[model samples]
Target: MTISMDQQQTLGLSPNTLKGVHHIALNVKDMATSRHFYGAVLGLHELTGDEVPETLVTLVAQGKVANFRLPDGTILDLFGEPDLDAPHADPKQQFTRANHMAFDIAPELFDQAVAMLHQQQVPIDHGPVSRPTGRGIYFYDPDGFLLEIRCDP
Candidate 1:
């Protein structure tokens, strides 16, 4: 989506000023479970050592943040909750319940991805629904965070 000079000026922003998403940060209930889920289950490689130097020491006591590298080189930062005993906000009650992250997959691998999810017994929220542009499947992570895997038609 290119922005014209006039549009950029009107918006007080420059065209091409912003590149792309560096990473997405999410608060997870359990670090170990989330780490295993993303790294082992999803096949995302964990970025350890220097990759995650500035950890969330302040937010969580003795807690560290983990960054996983996606196939596209996008990072997914999972931060463990500061207090596990504290009550978590219900996702159903939150206005952002519909908010989710969608990962693009190769068209050929779309069905394979669905099959993997099924083999793992992960509940499918909906889809293999079709659209003009593509097909997608919605599912939840261990933390109940909604995620989608989509492939362009």
Candidate 2:
């Protein structure tokens, strides 16, 4: 699956221009629950206004947006809209599916993470399934966003 320089040029992408994820944004039904799940259960530290640039205030104001920093320093933004009642497509269903997000975890911590999720009584949608790249578990957030925590093989 390696793409050569010519192929990358044709695709209008260069490796040097590509950087890791800066942030991942999510829309949820409840701010408190989302915060507890991400901050308490998942161990992502909530970032305060003093930590983020003031320029993002407007963009983050669409809902009760709260930003958190992952262990690796990546940002995860949660937007809570209590009145958002639109039906969402089920992640388990392949048709008309929305994208799912996966977080990388150390291989040794995979089992521990699974145990923690189980202990917290989070619904496990599917897995500890083995893939070519690693082992992963698909689980739901309080708002039903399908999320995965995986360890590289």
Candidate 3:
């Protein structure tokens, strides 16, 4: 099966207005650690997750599994206490390390993100360098996961 979506903003007709992704979820070793990297360091809004435990979170404490909404319909989810590496039986395990995810943020928002990362003492990688598609900033999460933040083309 194949699905096609063109980034078109339609006002009427059997129209289609497709944007970016809705969300992306990742695994972590610990909930608190994940929260620190994603919520504290990255400035993502801390929200309550009903399924998440309450003992470890007190409005300020690092909590499990949270979401960060990018400018587009892109949402980033950081989950915890799950497997970090692939199963040992998988033959393709050696080739999966290249996987990564990117977020679409406005240029102004990118500036704010840079400032926020600096405040958190988080190191940034490459620039707000201009690309044919958009401006982007590359950085690593607390777990050394590469993340790219870009804006509209």
Candidate 4:
């Protein structure tokens, strides 16, 4: 899957133009539950004031948006919409399960994460198994969005 310089030039590709993810926005069923899950269970910091974009806040009603900061400075924005009808993909198929967010944790905290998930009663959809990347687990959020926690060592 390596592309030569000529090929890259022919495709008008520019190196280093694309940056990593800035934020990920999701629509949730319950604001309180989602806030607790991301802010408490996962231990992410919730942003306030000008930290959130004015456009995103105005898209919905007031106080419907909650933004959580990841350890790597990526923002996870949650929109509270009680009647959201988002479709969840089945994890059995490869492509279907491709649409997921995977977060990395320290290798030592991997076991502790599993324990927390268990204590919280979140059902694991796939694994806490070893992969090319690391040990990981697939689980669903309260709103049925697929999420993964991987420990790279």
Candidate 5:
């Protein structure tokens, strides 16, 4: 993935803009469960994350591709691989939720998500920390994957 400086410039690339994320395809033990968490609870509609493709959608996104397009142009790509070993959910097993993939949210919603997750009996590790950039809260996903809801200053 290494690119020379001249090649990078020719691609209209800069360190920062290219630094932004495109999308993250997560490995899920079950797609249905993930859809319930990501789509139903989190409010991300499935652009396609289904086994059976709809007639019209296939007509639009092309008749062949099956990808879930989220509202923010971000695809909530889900993979159902029962054979994949789940990563260690314990923080001691890893550090910085960034290693897993932090799902940043609005600072205002951090408390709400925490309370909701708590009510649902989900595990939360850290506080609503305020960084020089913004605020964040850390928690674990269904598979014990660490995630963060953050807001930039």
Candidate 6:
């Protein structure tokens, strides 16, 4: 049996309507630190109040939020909720990378990104290792969330 476009949409499996991820939201312990890391260290542009939509402001009024735009226009939202607990990933577990975010960078800039991570004193948890896709450097955010910078080439 085959599924029609209308059937796919009805079942919420329509890839045509789903372009890509618009944003990723993370609960952060310290808003200022996370903001600086994403804004200053990672060099993502944080959206100002004027840049954020009024609808979003009203929706997330319970906690402070910092919106950072990736190069491709994807937004990373940091929600300020210090009390929220983050689950630690056990190295022995197969799902160590079960909840991580990866960012793409040019192959040539890979070295610079590694250097920047070091200059910022962010310890690399793993690679700068080669994979079928590309080289990647894994590190953690200030809130202990795993993050990776992979070469797009």
Clashes of each: 0, 0, 0, 0, 1, 0
Q: Which stretches of candidate 1 lie over 4 Å from their true place?
A: 1-9, 54-61, 82-153
Off by over 4 Å in 3: 1-89, 92-95
Cα deviation at 143, candidate 3, in Å, is 1.5
User: Can you list the residue pairs that collide in candidate 1?
Assistant: none
Q: Residue pairs in steric clash, candidate 3?
A: none
Error of 4 at 99 (Å): 10
Instruction: Give per-residue CA lDDT, model 1, range 5-35, as digits (tens).
Output: 7865654323443244445667776788988
Query: For candidate 1, which ten residues in a row score worst on lDDT?
Result: 12-21
RMSD of 3: 16.9
- Give candidate 4's root-mean-square deviation (CA, Å): 17.1
- TM-scores, each model vs. reference: 0.45, 0.48, 0.38, 0.47, 0.37, 0.47
lDDT of each: 0.69, 0.70, 0.56, 0.70, 0.55, 0.70
Query: Which digits, one per residue and each the tens of the lDDT, describe model 3 over residues 1-153?
Result: 443344221211122221234346566556667667767787765545553224224422444456565444455666554556555567656533322466666555666656665665666887768765566667788878767666665
Runs off by more than 4 Å, candidate 5: 1-20, 49-67, 89-153
Give a tens-digit lDDT track for model 4, residues 1-153: 897979755553234322444456677778889889999999998886766555555643476888888998987888777886446555354432123576667677777777777766787898888854467787888978877777664
Q: How close is candidate 1 to the true structure, as a TM-score?
A: 0.45
How well does candidate 6 score on lDDT at residue 93?
A: 46
What lDDT does candidate 6 reach at residue 63?
Answer: 47
Query: Least accurate stretch of 10 residues (summed lDDT) in model 4?
Result: 12-21
Minimal lDDT window, size 10, model 6: 12-21
Give the top-scoring candidate (TM-score).
2
lDDT of 2 by residue, 43-128 (tens): 88887767753545655565467889988787787767677554645646454223357677777777877877786688999998
